[model samples]
Target chain A: MFDNPERTNLEQLGEFGLIDHITKAVELKEPSTVKGIGDDAAVLDFSGKKMLVSTDLLLEGIHFDLRYVPLKHLGYKAVQVNLSDIYAMNGIASQITFSIGLSSKFPLEAVEEIYAGALLACQKYGVDLVGGDTSASVQGLVISVTSIGHADGEAVVYRSGAQVGDLICVSGDLGGAYVGLQLLEREKRIFLENPNIQPDLEGKDYIVERQLKPEARKDVVELLARLGIKPTAMIDISDGLASEILHICRASGKGCKLYEDKIPIDPMTYETAREFGIDPTVCALNGGEDYELLFTIRQADYEQVKGQPDISVIGHVTDADGGYELISKSGNVHPITAQGWNAFTSR
Target chain B: MFDNPERTNLEQLGEFGLIDHITKAVELKEPSTVKGIGDDAAVLDFSGKKMLVSTDLLLEGIHFDLRYVPLKHLGYKAVQVNLSDIYAMNGIASQITFSIGLSSKFPLEAVEEIYAGALLACQKYGVDLVGGDTSASVQGLVISVTSIGHADGEAVVYRSGAQVGDLICVSGDLGGAYVGLQLLEREKRIFLENPNIQPDLEGKDYIVERQLKPEARKDVVELLARLGIKPTAMIDISDGLASEILHICRASGKGCKLYEDKIPIDPMTYETAREFGIDPTVCALNGGEDYELLFTIRQADYEQVKGQPDISVIGHVTDADGGYELISKSGNVHPITAQGWNAFTSR
Candidate 1:
């Protein structure tokens, strides 16, 4: 996607020089930030709050395909994925360390494009770009991000906190990102077969954007706090709704009953799944990378979030012997299974 | 190097199962770690202390050659390199996130070997293995580590605090790791040339250990704190002594006069460099990956460190106009340059 003719060779600027060029404009905005960018390590002082940290590594072929993914969007998505982990804990992300391994094929402008996307995400999330390491890769690009966040000790949520009778809720719609991926992959194959024909993604803006630049649910955390409602358990939906719900069930030693009709699926996503010969319910259950918040709250707090516009109450926690099940719209119950993305398998 | 006859395929156990298998034995030793593995994010409470964070990415074939390097050693070195950055800031590393991307060729036992070494390092350094991401790579191994550390606000040091006439000092010996790398490369070539012949690496224990498993100088930070002596400026020597000194000079806006005779070099390193037909002083100057702490202390406080065993007084700082210079043992002055590892360049 990088067709800039005036590309500068990366070798012209050494590693230290490249770091200086990219981070020269960094301005730390957090009062807790004591040092950033130019130091051996970023320094921060968060006295009363508990610290939260999460890291993710994205490989070129396994985690992403550059043939259809833009470098800038890849950078933005990488940061969002890590920040999603922090937000899942009901914490406020404050800083991130972004490290990348680039092959010789990448030019200085390509790296700049990626950094611009990363910086843009940081700006939107109010996170400071702290410290990172840059190195050369043998073949393809590798992106690693570590997000640091903080929350009051009492406010932090864990996956093992869910209790029986809690209401299961999710923010925003699901299956959109998976449908977007299918469209992009189909377009990529067509373009490779015939370079002259343009991709037919004319009216698929919402799904495509959902796949390319999905946003973390930082606003959901803020909204819940504003409503004086705290989730008993929470997790970000990166590995499908089924997998995340199972994570909570396994951790909390409880079972769940999910209502299929209550699962929110965007119209575009449903239509696209039909076109791809896939079930919309299956897509919503197993499609990953939605970046939405899946959580549970006490039954007493149901009135606080009952009519929220973006929040959907999909199910409720049950006793361990009830087992994990999905009650279909037609009144049939099916056992829930986690068939989320398993990178080790070639499926 | 993994030649087990009955190797277990990684696909047999999915990503979550693999993570559980590898980290099941991890015991949290730090009181600050409120939560560790098996969570969306690790939680820590470093109350009343300034937090330091750093990250590093290491790729196969680019950062290391698996043909000569052991997987366990690679894992150990990756964690050590990141911890070195924390110690450079005069902090105590307490927690780390270790993420890796493995290809299909690697068996489950191979990954366990790497984690074993990583756990060993964590046990030795009193750092907790908190959380990480594991995925599959298309080709080679990819390792990324993020180290979290803490120090009292008053005890933290920075690279930009050096003053004119400050004494430049470095801990431990230099050039050993570089020479050790040379020895390993020579043996690899010899083995490649003759399949049936055994390569030789006799009586090179110290230098080889330095290269294969370099330790972070956490002890130096503790020693300085115990002596009630804080460095005016400090940095870890990862990109060679010359590069690190220049970093201090550039950040502090000062010049330095490094004495070639005062640069500490192990006797085995000196002999090995001569045997390889290389200049010992040049190796000491530009050879990287030593993992030693280089710092500057005020002249008035020099008395505290003058009689220390492993520390050496290499030079003194000067006004910016004096420029960075190295006075050779033969009385000739030469400008210092950073010929450190530039990943983009083949050299």
Candidate 2:
């Protein structure tokens, strides 16, 4: 699958040689990282701060199609997915350990490209690339990332901390990533049918980038801190807005009222959903992988976040007895249910 | 392949259901665990101490074969392997994040058995299962474990700290895991040839368990601490003696003399290797996955650890120009070379 001009076989360098070649350029940027890469275990000091740990596993075929997903983008997204979890907890990620398993079909250059992308993300996020494991897989590529971060214990946001009357807010836009995936998948089928036809992905850059290069909402977290507002409950939108909102309500032992008209959707995403004969509202509610922040803020703090262009107030928290409900633009009220994709059955 | 009387398909529980079912029984025993599971990230308190992090990825066909490996043992061994890296650094592991991707072929009971084994290891090691990710793979099972630990700055060890006059010591015995694997492969071959034949594995419990359920050298680390001995350099013997010692030598810019006769091999391992027409010394030198500690201490501190039965002083460090050499039983000296299994090329 790799189309690189220089194709060095994996066996020629061996596992240790490949690790050295890939990580030789890695410079530890975090002061917390006492040791990185060379040792059996990386050493870090997060004294006086509570540490946050999260991991994500991405499998080829199940998570992404190699035909459309570039190796560099796959590696970058894998790290981003894990980092989003740390941000969701209002923590700043300081270090990450990336592990990968791939078959011999991957050449040395392909592996290098993946690490280059991972290192780029680490550099941009100001996190050190710590220790990791690399091995040969029997089939496709598998990536697992563990992100370590720290925050003051009192400042950490949790899904179970929402209170009644808290305003539900979301950052940036939603449904763009899911729309982007649909566009990519459609183009893949066309290319497979006729290799001569190039992918017609022009002018869809915003949505396509959403699918290929989603970034964690680090800026949103910083903005909230600058505004001196702490979210009562928070989660990253990975398994769609409906699923994530349900998680918050379940954990907090409360319910929420979501307004369909208030859900943020970019113009490009809305038009693309209509082109695919799908409801844009449905896409925003159930389409996942946006990496946007969904959180609850006390009513008194609404004035500070409402003035921010990127933050959209969508709903409000309610008592558990009220049940989760959605208010449509036409004033139709319906129970909000989770239609999140179950990886086990969806594949 | 599963012969269990009750089989619950993974799809029946879905991703969230499966995670809840598996982790409902997990009890957070560590005081450092501020929050375990059920959140965007696991919160931990490692105040005033340096945190040690390590990760390991295991693939089914490449790292193991289900035809011979039981699910519970596989789960147990995966955790042990990662924890061994922490012990190699003279750190006490306090938490682990386990991520698994398996195909639908596995039943819920099988997954439960695997988690049971992992939890059992956590209980025994005084570590907490803090966070993890679960997803469906397209093929066989995949597990990635990240272990986090802590140790005092002075007590922590690294492979690059060895000096010229330091003595080399190894805990427990070597080569039993490899010899046991050979026996298991033989039994499988015999069973494949005759479907009705019951293979003989009686009187081979020690070697067989070594292959299936190898334990990390936590006790050895404890013993050294109690005896007021700290190794200048330390590493876990996961990649055989020659390869690990070479790592120390290369990292420390030093060399070593290893005596073949001093290499400790269990009688069961030696007998089994002889039965297979393989040299026991060669097995001890190159057989991976022993999960024992190989370390170097100052020569002046030799009297304290010399009487310890489990610790074997096999050799001493030398200058970089001296090169790595092994002294044979007949007094012939030869350069020590690494024959550790290269996962990429070996298959």
Candidate 3:
């Protein structure tokens, strides 16, 4: 995906030259963006509104394997993940600063491809590319994106607001990204073993795409606003469902009762998990990188969200004294354990 | 400086636990910071002012050698450099997001020391540590800091506002950081050759400190404001003075004439440069990481700043056709060339 006919060495361009080259075509779309690329810092005006800020760092081997992950998709996913945090706060992302520490092994064309993917995401989300720093690294590519957003003071949501009667809701299906990762890793190993074979990704487009280029749930935030429903507490499902649920519960000083049967899993995700000899429910509970919104709403607002096509009412909030439990499909209860991604040990 | 008796593996704490431990003492001081460190994203209110945003990526080997650099000073310098960009725009920085990608070599205590230094900087500057990501790196440590600040619409400065007759001025002294780096590198080489030999850093405290913990000139920004002198064009001298001058000249469609003798160089820096068999003028011209403000003021405002103790009037801006030149003390004029730190090619 990153093959280019004419490759220019990065050293020939230097830092300033490379910056001028990459930002030459940048077009700012937000009126609030008073100043963009060239200045020491990007100037913005968010008068009368509250601002939201979040940052995420992605390392080459730890967060991704460049042998399988395309630079374009990596760039796009980096921005999407940071934007997911903003959407989790019920805010609209307005600007982003995309900085990279790239090694010389990457040519100018590779960096340009990464920027192309980043700009595409900004175009799609209406977020302005403000300012960033590009420095040479000794190892592989390192991407750090900081997203800025704005929202009305009263409309912003936090994870510590859920009440005992709040309904635990989630947007879109779960576990597809994890299943997709397994497919990619399996194919990568197979390809390494036998170079003659192509990747067996023919019929797994949905799951594969879910892993390669996950989208932030901006539509769900808009939908909630249109329906006049505000989540009492919210968080993006980057760490598996179990871990995120625990975070919300701990922050809100409450407990949660999650229903395994109510969790929405796509048919492809379920079949793939079974093929891998893994329980589908376990994947839904522990698999991560869904980029979906997990939120809680007041019981009085249940009527407004129950029938929504994209949202599923999977569980309910409970008192702090009540332990966090997951109701199994067979009418048995199990303690919710966080088996989410631990970067230090797992990778 | 980084000797910790109790060493705990990072894997034992996990990501969330490490973050909680590092940021446990972070006290938010900015009134605009509505919420910090715990939510999906930080919340701030820049209701009546323009916001300035900038990001920088610092890699371990390329930016600093950990063998000689203490983690605490590295963390502090990283924040100082990013804040320098905001101050270069004549903005008062209010918040920052500091993210790090660490390898297994770093223990929990080392990471804590880094955070301690970062928190100290935030406290001194009255900026809040809002939100950031902590991930495991496959190689050396990587830091990414995003600083956010506010400025009045009319008070903010840009690089593209210089005129034909603007006076070029600089804050504090130059070349000390570069000379300090040379001293450190020489000592590092000597120590590696024989472990028994201590570093010969006697009588070089000023230059060594300049390289280890350079301060951002926020005082200059305040001084400019106090004197009611708004710069016509401005940039922080992260790169050499020649490169920064070229940036302003290219952006503003003007040329410049810098007086070599007028450039500020500390006495220790000059003597050290002589000891290293390098010209003091060359060190002042090409040495980077000064973290000083290099700006241009209208000739009419020159009287207000000429006698300032820390500010030096280096030269004057000229028409685009005049070209960028430097006048030597020996009555020789030569075109100024940029030999700044080119990360891709130099290292």
Which regions in candidate 2 have their CA more than 4 angstroms from the true location? Answer: A1-5, B1-5
Q: If ranked by lDDT, best first, what sequence of candidates would result?
A: 2, 1, 3
| Candidate 2, number of clashes | 0
- Runs off by more than 4 Å, candidate 3: A1-5, B1-5
lDDT of 1 by residue, B183-252 (tens): 9999999899997877677899899999999999999999998888999999999889999999999999
**RMSD list, candidates in order:** 1.0, 1.0, 1.4
Better of 2 and 3 by DockQ: 2
TM-score of each: 0.99, 0.99, 0.98
- Tens-place lDDT per residue, model 2, A127-164, is 89998999999878999999999999899999999999
Question: lDDT of model 2 at residue B2?
Answer: 69
The candidates' DockQ values read 0.88, 0.86, 0.86
Clashing pairs in 3: none
User: What's the true lDDT of residue A53 in model 3?
Assistant: 96
Sliding window of 10 residues with minimal summed lDDT for model 2 chain B: B1-10
Give the Cα error of residue A313 in candidate 2, in Å: 0.7
Work out the iRMS of candidate 3: 1.0
Q: Model 3 in CAPRI terms: which quality?
A: high
Chain B TM-score against the true chain B, candidate 2 = 0.98
Clashing pairs in 1: none
> Per-residue lDDT of A1-347 in model 1, one digit per residue for the tens?
34567777778887877898889757789887889888889999898799999999999898889888888898899999999999999999999999999986788888988898899899999999998988888868999999999999999999998999999999999999999999999999999999998999988999999999999999999999999999999999998999999999999999999999999999999999999999988888899999999999999998989889999999999989999999999999999999988899975
Return the top candidate by DockQ: 1
